[model samples]
Target: MKDAWKRWGAEDERGALNLIGPDEVRRAVSLVKSGEVVSLAQPLSSKTPGPKHRCGLQHFMNRDGGDYAAGGRRPGGFQFSEDSVVMPLHIGTHIDALCHAWYDDELYNGFAGNSIRSTSGASRLGVDKMPPIVTRAVLLDFVQLRGKPLAADYSIGRADLLEAAAAADVQIGRGDAVLIRTGWLESQTGVTDVSFDIEPGIDVEAALWLAERDVALIGADNYAIEVLPFPAGKVFPVHQRLIRDYGVPLLEGLSLEEIASRKRSTFLLMASALPIVGATGSPLAPTAVL
Candidate 1:
């Protein structure tokens, strides 16, 4: 297995996020000359497509127009509507907290992971602890380069990353968010045939490569950021190494199609995790401004 340790110190919860200092933010701002902002989040709804095991997004209206029609009185002839949502935070465009995946009963930065706080959520390194992510980002359009979506079982290696970066003429730097486009999300044409178990994503080598460059975040257009069906004799190698060992956040299920279509490979990225206390993950709606 790959090595696991904390460079941000034992008490640190932000992990590689610590790399995003003032200079990183200022450098990101310099990439915004075009003033064009594009959303990189998929809409969240009960109707949103997701794997069966995730249970799907559920939405309910607490009050609506039907209330008054059913003889329910309105105060001062005024009416309003309220709604509620119940769904897994990992279902939509979401970011996994540093404590999300671990092994040997230890989380990122050596936090105890054995005693899970099921009711209250993660006892440490929850999504709330994550700061708003603002920095430079570079998109790797692997789909367009391949002329189609990569295979479900495809393992994206470090060479692929370098090739794509060179093609895009973008030099990935420290504190930058690297969003890889697999073209998998747009290939969602049906429910039963959806390849949920397997996906095309970065391999462990690629993940370590980014970690070497001190990337703050890693994202993908697929549900899982690493190749699914995993490498032979391996399981979630990227997740364990990146999130647990390197303390990098994983942004999955993003909408990179629009930005890729525009051929904008580099931009200023701004994303925030919902301040859900102790939650292991949070739904995200990141934006890229060129």
Candidate 2:
């Protein structure tokens, strides 16, 4: 872990994202063939399930001709409508900022966790520091590789990632965005359990492997990018290793069924966390261009 922190630099905050340069963007652009785009975000609504501590979206609309009307009538009695939404930053498909996780008392880049927070939010390593991500995205469909939807207790390790990549005939490269599809999200319809229900995700060993490869970001269709009902005595070890130690961001609650349906191994991915200053995370709307 110490070596992981030192590999980037003492002053760096963007971490693995630094691997994506002009060349990477150009390479990503070259992967687009069909010009078809698929959104990777789940629809946000009042019924949307989220973490226990986070509330789902609250949408308010001002319709035409009501007491809270959007505006006055136009030339031919035309009016406008307006809407607003409020929800936790991590509710939907989202990116975790460098400040989103910490080990003991320190955050990524060695920022003291307690000292960096106030009523407003984190004073350093906020989501606003995250740059727009444009890179090659590789989909590793574990459901297809394993011939079944992984069980809640299943832990995907380095071997699973390697085998999936090999099976897809795609090479995971530095600065690339990797989307792991466990089919968990797709299986959640009509589920009575809360959003925090057990789900399959990468294990700590696989996280370290990704960190070594310099992946810019890793996302999944599960609620969290790491297996839930965490191994006894281990509290989000994978998250600590990836975010706190390696400075790599996590994208959770992604919608990958559409992208996976295409059966393409590589595509152009565009995703950017909302630049909310001092925020620990931000809602994201990632897209895959095929």
TM-score of each: 0.95, 0.93
lDDT of each: 0.88, 0.86
RMSD of each: 1.6, 2.1
Model 2, 1-290: lDDT tens digits are 54356566777778778889999999999999999999999988888888777777999975645743545557576556778888899887889998988888888878788846577787778888899999999899988887878897688999989999999998788889999999888888787666585889999889888888888999999988998878889888888988888888999999988888899989999988888989989988999999
RMSD of 1: 1.6
TM-score of 2: 0.93
Model 2 score (lDDT): 0.86
Error of 2 at 280 (Å): 1.0
CA shift at 47, candidate 2, in angstroms? Answer: 1.1
